[model samples]
Target chain A: MSDAEIAVRDLTIRYGQHVALKGASFEVRPHEIFGIIGPANSGKTSFLKVLNRMDTFTAGMHFEGQVEVGGRDVRAWRNLYALRRQIGVVFPLPVGLPLSVYDNVAFAPRLAGVRAKADLNVIVEGCLRRAALWDEVKDRLNALGSLLSGGQQQRLTIARALSQKPRILLLDEFSIAVDPVTTMRIEAVLSELKAEMTIVLVTNLVQQARRLADRTAFFLMGECVTVAPTEQFFLRDADLDPRARDYVEGRFG
Target chain B: MSAPPPHPDTAALDRRDLAWYVDKLVAVLVFVGGVSAVVFIVGIFAFVTHEGWGFVSEHFSLRGFFGSIRWAPTSTSNPTYGALALIAGTASVTGLAMLVAVPFSLGAAIYIAEFATGRTREVLKVLVEMLAAIPSVVWGFIGLSVMNPLIIDVFNVPIGLCVLNSGLILGLMAAPIMTTIAEDALKAVPDTYREAAEALGATRWQVTRRVVLPAARQGLLAAVLLGVGRGFGETMAVLMASGHAINLPTSPFDSVRALTATIAAELGETAVGSTHYQALFALGIFLFVVTFVINLSADLIVRGIRKT
Candidate 1:
């Protein structure tokens, strides 16, 4: 559809001779939280990497088929950096980037040529606030980002991901290293973020998808088994794929 | 029916076997091998100090030895042991060599660590190691035969062997080890740092300069310091390239004699227990101390990186 922010067609990814994901097709709509749930080795992370062209540096990683974002083929972009700047990604574990907490949030903005200190301070404060980390680290913004606690580092990473004002945000298991309280806090932040940018959330928690995602996709053994609205997806219905139902019901993954 | 469990006393889990004896023996042997390095270093230091102690107490004057430039150890009339000219010669030549080597070695290291990949990186690394393994005498030969006439023709100086020649030779001699250490430093930086920076839309150069370089700065400093230490201790190449005239050089074209070169050139001619011989031993002590301090500080700086 014209409104779709990301459109994938027959996307297959491989590492050397082994296929990581095969024959997948989907579309992510604008201003919506799209959740992808799968067990380990189901290619959720690989799919996220392809969105920002991280595959370029990953040796032996190959992908076939078209992935279009903003009505253009991702592979057709001559300047991959520009393409990546439009998309933000957060990894499973926190990456605090051997820099100060303030610098971590300001990194992307500085790369985009924001030079004035006052402007940087404003952007950093705003992103940190949005990530719900400002109150905790406001006084110690100059401290090393890596020195922060695990939960704080994850939030700092989220703040950094937000600094670019990206059109799409790809998060891979943002709650893995976060405490339950911090996870709930971040989940609230994501709900607010969906009003501004599209989010592709890959999570192991099925109920988390229920709590946040507007629509959800089920990936099983490297295949896209089904995609449905969050409400109907969890319902035990004849139309629902039995494999997805079994996975969501915790029978087997 | 299930088999009967083995009795605890009969099992004898703690009993020593042939492998245990071999392990203990190997451990003792390796411990001695490791301790021998420290032992040898201490022994050498003790010997140098013992030889130089007589000169220090009986004939040594701190001012004449350090301040005066005239190094007339053989003159029966005065026999002054001034080493200022030699010290300045060593300092100046090493300074110039660092000027020549730092940029070259760092550039090569960055290229190998960040840009080159696969077969190219492997081949370049092997070649650098091979260069490091080249004997100092061979490098001395290159300086004597190739660089001598070339420097004379290019600079229009009367003497081909001068600070310029020796510094250039020394620079080339030190570059291989410096490059190797610097590459190791860069390699020590985690790939995650590079990937994170790259994912944030930073260019490759930006990633290297902003992320990787800052992360590896301590190790890089250690690499440069180790190169300086190597320059201070090198003998054959500097002796061959330097003109061996003791002088306070005002320019790179002026001929000079290094401290290491002086010990190497005249150590054979002096009689036993002679003041001139003892003075040379004093110089040896000085060189040993300077090199030791440099290497120790470099090691400490590298350890600082690990602590962080």
Candidate 2:
């Protein structure tokens, strides 16, 4: 109702016989940071993967119900390339393709049909700057991306995702390997980027959701328990589910 | 406070010692097996060089080795030990074989790794492996019986036993090795890389060409190098398929003798310790060096890839 950029209605995901996501319904509004928080095996990362159809790469993944991205059903979209171009994903562990830092960021733009070196240079620098990585990597752009520190590599992954100029960015536990300082820096960067695109941030840390998310969804045992404004949920209103409150308060996973 | 007393686990320690000793014994046995390979190779190298040293010291000249044009080693009065023709023959045939195999092997590897799935992929992989198991003599026989006549009919050559015939046979023999190694290299690439490429809107082919190939570049190079080594060392196939004429082939159609073929054809009959016999050993030495360098480089490339 509030001009959702992505809408999922009764979505369920399974890998072989095991259900990873069960009957989840949610909406992410445009230009807002939507946070998902849950314990292990709660389908948080799985939900992020389904946004860009990244789950198709895995074998025997089954999905039911509907997922609409930018007002079009993802299942009905014939052009997978066009669909993927609109949504970008950063994996939990930063996998910078064993290439130079510049090439890692430029890879998406080149695939998106930008061939000119000058054009790629501008886009690469702009995205790197936006990811808070330009300052550290500006001098050694030719160095291999795999050679970067954990935090820098995570930021490089962010820059790579931003290079596609996606309508929505999906992050899966991006700070799992990052130090606290770098995590805070990336949070600030994401906050600034939300003016241009919607962001789906899946975190194991509830405090991260409390700090950065405009709206938050709490998932428990493959089910979405509740979706509410971050302030309302964290302030412990009577409407909040007990399990969600317990999880947010660190009473138990 | 004093440190806590140690627990009584002497019996457990004794049992662990027994297991450790057994592990050490097995490790030492494997180590010996590994060292034996080096010992045998060094022994072979010593024997070949020792056997060829007399001819090398007396009759070996730079002019006859690299500069001379003819390779007639059986002349009664004036036997020429010039190997430029044989070396050129080996190069041309191996080059042609590589030319035929590289594209096909790489294409098959790409298909197997990127396109083929499930049973189709398994079948294709097994077929390629089975191709490697086929004896070289069988391949040579096929070249002689089927391919020769086909070549003659297609090209109108008087005799089909030429460099081209041997090259084609060698290419077929080498393709399986190339494909297996290259496919392994492609498959070794992580799925995360593919997913990363796809999430950025790259098509399957684009991901393969841009990401997978570049990532596997070193491994692919090692594969090609190993294929070249395999083709260069092959004896029975080239001996039976090639015309074995000791001539400098001006074109692919001309009959020529490779170093391995020359060794196979003449080494059995050459009188022991004669100039001809030693020259054959010299050719063996040359083949050993070339293949050694090729295999060593391939190993280095593979190691570098593993390190990265």
Candidate 3:
């Protein structure tokens, strides 16, 4: 419990009578990339929602069992905002807020009470640089964020997520709207970020897990099918769960 | 593999059927329906200008019409048709109405759009729309009977049928429509923006203020403008509540007359082709132009939002 940055024990998420994820148990170690690969409707997004208590606002979304971030259960935090500040989330599609590009990246920092113009300028530039977007957008940070290309907007979203300086970053299929080259650039950014915070990368691309995750978990049909170190998880004759092996090998989603 | 089936005859496939005729007929009908709106607007404008033209050419002077405050058209030896007082009265009441309506409507819109959920949201929306449906004459009755006494008693004014009374009535009358439009504007902001801001640790208020309100700014501005238009064109309520006196109101406590009220009150009594009658038509023309400008600007602002 002390060693793990995020610990889940028998976590189940239900939307009314429909169970989205069931009895999941896993741990994400501090400063490590933990990938969750699954097909559509496999509950990967729902899992990410529970990590930051986002389920609270979702109608009829009920959660059971324990989800701990930093040795404390998420529900135990009296202030939901405080809990969310520790965990940043990127959605399946890039959502460029209806604001200027500079304002979009500065949003989280402003919320965290970073009021100084100089301080905000620094954070906005630093995050945009790390997200690999500053060079392209520096000339026009005053432009509306939504006016940017899909790929640039995705990088802006990443910059926004990083602005909060979260302890855990959750990305749910962030590459869906981005180009391959930009996706590669973001992958590089995430690899570098692994040293600072825990990351839960939920992706449809299975090979992405092999490339970035220190340990990868395969989710299938609302269940945590397997969680293993990357080397052991992809070994040809490692006696893995057949579903995990088949899914990873492009046999079936 | 096997012998191909005969192709369908191109002439048979291309033949116009009953459905095609019906579709053409419907299109023609819809086009007429759309064009009729523009026709009616032009017709109304033409009629108002035609009726007011005699007075404009014969008796009208720019200084007397807009600058002078003496509106005495039946003074036997010296008939002056100055509308400065009426214009001032209307402007004062509409301005006050906005002051009252903007805050109330925006708060309700924010509540219904952001905080209220499920049955509460639905019920609140329906209630706001129902409030909008309450007749202006009924609101005038309330202003006359209910608000008049309340204002007199609350402020210890000698008379309550003043700018304050009518402004309050007009504000209440305008708020429901404003709230409905403002709620729609707020709802038009995508939910993904909220989710994105929330994920970045922003509280609900912070998200609404920083993201939702800014996104909906143009729509909200249009809503407020529409409310101003509603206040301007309102006749019965302002006629009943505003004391129907031609005065340049300097304070809320001063009784004032509005442009619409003047026409509604004076048009029937005056001779049909007389200078006074045509002058009332002139006021009608003024009201028409101002409201038209407000509505057009609101429409343009809403359209500007869509282009972005």
Candidate 4:
């Protein structure tokens, strides 16, 4: 009944005796910028890792969940690679690959069998431009990516992710270490990218979630207290639940 | 303000202060040790270059140095002392060792460092360290006992001490160095790189081939350099396995002598003030320079990776 691009039902994650997420459920709307806001150690990373099937929870520490992206159960998909190709990710830290600037962006497409030089050039340039990194690094495509500044490195990482031409982009604190100006630049880029890709942001900063998210999910103690449109979630949280009221009133995290 | 907290705090500080002073002293000692290592290496290069310049630069010395195949520097009739025999031996042994050792050692290293975990990784590290600790003389004794007979009789390769035997010894000797260095390089790679590759749905082998190895390129080069240097500089194992022949080895089955062995073999009996003695010294120069160049190349490669 919901027009959700991604639907999570009966989601639960446990790390040994510690429960990370209790029976969590949420719907991510298509092409919407969805923000996940939680304090440190609140299972944001664990949840994101599960979504990508990157979590290696011990056998006993099971995740009881169903995650469907584009109406296909993510776990049941016959080809995980095909699913991944449609959803790009930028990690919390800038994972600048040990490759030349151009190759970092060229890697995925090449792996996916886009071997034509002309197509590669177009893809790399377009992604870099979308990442707002083209003008600075256009002349140094052959240089090692590690030589770039922290901000530039993050942009390059974003460019690399974009090269996958994903329908969904997952960002985990993409601007955490960069300068404020660069953070704003990335936020602007995400604003534009949302028209083409469903953007999911995991952040600790409330102001950031309010600025960029169309809908926001507030998590506390491994539970989603509520998730609603950004304006309603922030303005109408006082009467929703005690935890939500305290969190919204700034009395607690 | 501090006086108010003088109950238990002052005594705690007094205890910690002593530990802090000792820690500072330990840090100073470590700093001095690091600098001394640098000074020691630099001094050796400077001293060797200063002493061996005449031989290194001399046209006659260098020509007779690398171009000939002579080992009887003490032979009264004709003291032949050309480095060709030694260079040929070193090159053959090192090349063979690399061919056999590089792929196997790197594969094992990648398996242990990137793939293995828990008790398996710990066991691998312990095994590698133990192998490295096994003394050179023990390796020489191994070649003399277990390896020597196998080559001549069981293996039935002609010239029991030949390029093949020497190569096998060098390969085994270089294994620990290769695995340890290569594993270190692989470990130095950030875990995030692997995670990113995996998140992109790359299989284990594909991730290793495409992401891990390329990221660990500088370290892998260093690892290879360390392996080659160990094999080239190794004297006793090669001496025991090689037939000490001065001629060119035509194949793996043929006998050959390397430079390190020649130096070891000739240095003891060369009479003082004889041309044979000087020529042996010249061989020492060649061995020293070659090892230095290998180590230098490793340093340059690591630097090149950093600059980019």
Candidate 5:
């Protein structure tokens, strides 16, 4: 079989009177850095939420398609916690828990039923180092999470998500609120993470997708216009849709 | 530039400086008023201590207090001024009240804030506020006339008013305040926190417990403390349903006396300078101190939450 880890087929989601995903379809390959490029208000976040059944439009609304992850219907799964353990999410802004930095990273694993102190310490340390936050927060892991600076806190959030050893990392504009230098560092970290986990980044930044993503999908007005190799989608004339070109070229109505 | 050569317009500068001086004076006056407002709370403690000082220290005979079944203040006999029985009665009633109040209050708060639809939430919110506004006396009368007789008959108890009577009355009264404050606290939690947890595939119950409740822990604590304070200090409801007995209550069906009830019932008949009168004053002092500690603890928790 092919190595695609997740596939969405003709997924249409609506909330009462509003449609969030209109016949959207895509596939994410294993260990790939795939970017979902969209302008603001394009319903990209909603589509991502639908992957984990976190969409608010679940009741009184219908989905007209199937989302299969690892050859299983995403909806039919009983071990949702285990499934979620293999898939983590980082929100746009840093969500600082009212807990200490150590507890923040240790949260998911503990929830995943990792109770032993030695095991938790190992997982926390490994994830923090992987997220490149250990050096900065190594000594003050006992400090409250809100005490960290913005970029550092965002990195801490990623470490917290990664502590569960997820197979796919869903990042919704993880570095959008950070400085340019910090954003570049996060971009580098994403490239490193791409070697082990599938990284699906939902970003409004067209240039960052151009710079890093191997395959990019362009979302416009709640529809995926094109999904192609990043270089061809950006450089080749025929591979680009008019809307995609407009967005990539910085022209929006 | 030497401050731009004094701005070249000394008279204009002087006018601006005078206005600034007047503003500073007003600001200082306001600051002083703020400080004195804090000092005003300190003064309440002083006033209570000044009048009720020795009465608090004057020891009552525990033998006379517990042995004598009669607590009446006759014209000739020495008054058997005992609050031990009254204190025991108060603890039992309030404890039962808390048992009924806490869970229902928290459940109502969770529903109103997290689960209820928008219109339903609004209606429930208004109803809770209206319940909070209902006079304690009105609630007392309702309990005495409507609820007391029903409970006595349902349980087939001898006392028409019992510990359960006071508990049910105060529990109903305290529910609204707990629900309102707890809802506000739960609502204060940012939406993004819930979204993040849900995205992690946590069930709704898990999200509520692990994320929402922990996030609102301080607020929930404050709500419980506030409820305890209210149940402890409530006079009218307790007076009406507590049966006004100055003896140890043996069961939930037994009549009881609380601190507020003892003071209220006995303060009028005792002579002005008698030990009996001062002991009632001492009970008032005791109630005040208990409520003060409760409120102070709530304040400390709230401040700690704010700092975090």
Candidate 6:
């Protein structure tokens, strides 16, 4: 079998005495859409944060077990910059930095030592195009990113994530601040993005998972209850654990 | 559920009775107290300008006031009141103070806000507050007794009382305020900016330089402006540490006198209504205008930053 793009084994996360995730393990295949659906505080965001080591910003966060990307152990990597550069994350809210729209998308590339103005222009335009935000902001590239509409800001953030040229993209409720039309546009963008990199999508909207995700995981409390292909989970006699079936059916969360 | 019993005495009192009148009376008194502060500031401005009216009416020459280098106001023959020397002195001392204070306080602010954690940050904050609480007279004494000897020995100068000496003391006085205000500004930047920057592979230093500082630019600018205002108006420390010479400072080591120091040193000796006294009041007017312009420009810049 081909190696998993991301492999996790008994990943446990804690904030002081509070356990955020309890020995959860999963794998995501390359070029596939992996959806994580859970109620609030079920560790979906925490799990995404751990992928790019963004959780280090939180005080008193403790982690156990292993997370490997492309067969390399994440913890063993000494250069966090190089590791994080390979993975991108989009947050729930659209937090456009207080910078020009063009500069916002060009930020990552500039950080990675891309100094040529021509190269930056290409990267910024290309990323904006892939995020489906190019037409709306093409004329206002010099305008402040904070001035963009909420939906446009969300797309700008996605464009910024793409600018990193990440191998894996983790999105946490990216459509929460996005309208349905923008959401549909982004869903199309995601379908295109999966051809280039693996996508880990954590969503509150279960229907988003049904439409996009090739594989789905259900989380409850702090435990990942099940991981199955999307079609099998939707089947009536799908051999899923009864609780997973009830959750998928909207009987109880 | 049963209704709770009401107090008979409370029930008899109307909402708009004596208690309400007392509340309104207290509110008006507090409002008047707040307004009194503005009144006092305006009153001082008016009194100074009124006393200095003679200089404005008769002796005011833009060239004589600002063009000449000498500041021999008490000369028996000519009584030259040229402020060019004094202005140069004030600029050099205050500029030196800013040069020393800005980098030090900004670094301290960033360290306290972003790098220091928990017990360290709390202890540093308390220490900074204590530094701010130290009286200007105490700082002046320290500069005179301790810093003077050290500067004399190190630089091998004939005298330690110079623009550099006054500047260093003023810088110390401004450091605590600048650091405190700048730290508050840096801390006010949302955690989300840091998180987003970090997720994009930014190191902590990079995030601080690129994201945090730019986000807090307006507040940081205000912090620098307030520091300048504090240094510009400082008197006791400059009066003690500076040599009180009315000469253009050629170098950081040259003896000089600031406007505030001039006012502090000579105001007591000048008679009530002499041209010298009026000139001093005129100096007060200049100081007020300079500080007002600085603060107003800073406000404009902050507003401009917000509009972007």
Per-candidate RMSD vs. true structure?
A: 2.4, 2.4, 2.0, 5.1, 4.5, 3.5
Q: Distance from true position, residue B294, model 2, in Å?
A: 1.0
Residue range A1-253, candidate 1, lDDT tens digits? 4768999999999999989889999999999999999888898998998999999878889999989999898999999999988998888999999999998888889999999999999999999999999999999999999999999999999999999999999999999999999999999999999999999999999999999999999988889888899877766654888888888889987
Q: B1-308, model 4: which lDDT tens digit per residue?
A: 55565476566655656779899999999999999989998887676555545544553455576667766665668766677877888899889989888987998899898778778989989998898888877777777687777877977765577887778878888988888888988887778887776666566677788988987889898889988988889998888888888878788877888888887887788565455555656666667778889988988887776664
lDDT, residue B247, model 3 = 96
Regions more than 4 Å wrong, model 4: A1-3, A56-62, A77-79, A132-152, A178-185, A188-192, A236-239, B1-60, B144-156, B270-275, B303-308
Alpha-carbon runs more than 4 Å astray in model 5? A1-4, A13-16, A57-66, A78-83, B1-75, B115-120, B141-157, B268-279
Sorted on TM-score, best first, the list reads 3, 1, 2, 6, 4, 5
* Candidate number achieving the greatest TM-score relative to the actual structure: 3
How do all the candidates rank in terms of lDDT, highest first?
Answer: 3, 1, 2, 6, 5, 4
| Residue B198 in model 4: lDDT | 64
Across A101-138, the per-residue lDDT of candidate 2 in tens digits comes to 99999998888789999999999999999999999999
Q: Please give the C-alpha DockQ score of model 6.
A: 0.69
Error of 1 at B68 (Å): 1.6
Error of 1 at B142 (Å): 1.6
Error of 5 at A159 (Å): 2.1
**iRMS values for every prediction:** 0.9, 1.0, 0.7, 2.6, 2.7, 0.9
Scoring only the A-chain of each prediction against the true A-chain gives TM-scores of: 0.98, 0.97, 0.98, 0.93, 0.94, 0.98
Residue-wise lDDT of candidate 3 within B1-308, one digit each (tens)?
Answer: 99988777868788999999999999999999999999999999999999998999998999989999999887899989999999998999999999999999999999999999889999999999999999999999998999899989999998899999999999999999999999999999999999989888899999999999999999999999999999999999999899989899988999999999888888888998899989989998999999999999999999998887
Model 3 spans with C-alpha error above 4 angstroms: B1-15
Worst 10-residue lDDT window for candidate 3 chain A reads A230-239
Q: For candidate 3, write residues A17-135 as lDDT tens digits.
A: 99999999999999899999877788899999999988977989999999999999999999999999889888989999989999999998898888999999999999999999999
Q: Candidate 2: where is the Cα deviation over 4 Å?
A: B1-28
Local error of candidate 6 at A140, Å? 1.4
Interface RMSD of 5: 2.7
Give the alpha carbon lDDT tens digit for every residue of B1-308 in model 2.
99888867757755656779899999999999999999999999999999999888999999988788677778998888889888888888899999999999999999999988778999999999999999999999998998889989999999888899999999989999899999999999998899888988899999999999999999999999999999899988888778888888888889888999988888889899998999999988989999999999999999998887
lDDT per residue, candidate 5, B208-280, as tens digits? Answer: 8887899898999999899999998999889998888766888888888888887787788878756767767
Residue pairs of candidate 2 with colliding backbone atoms = none
Error at A73, model 4, angstroms: 4.0
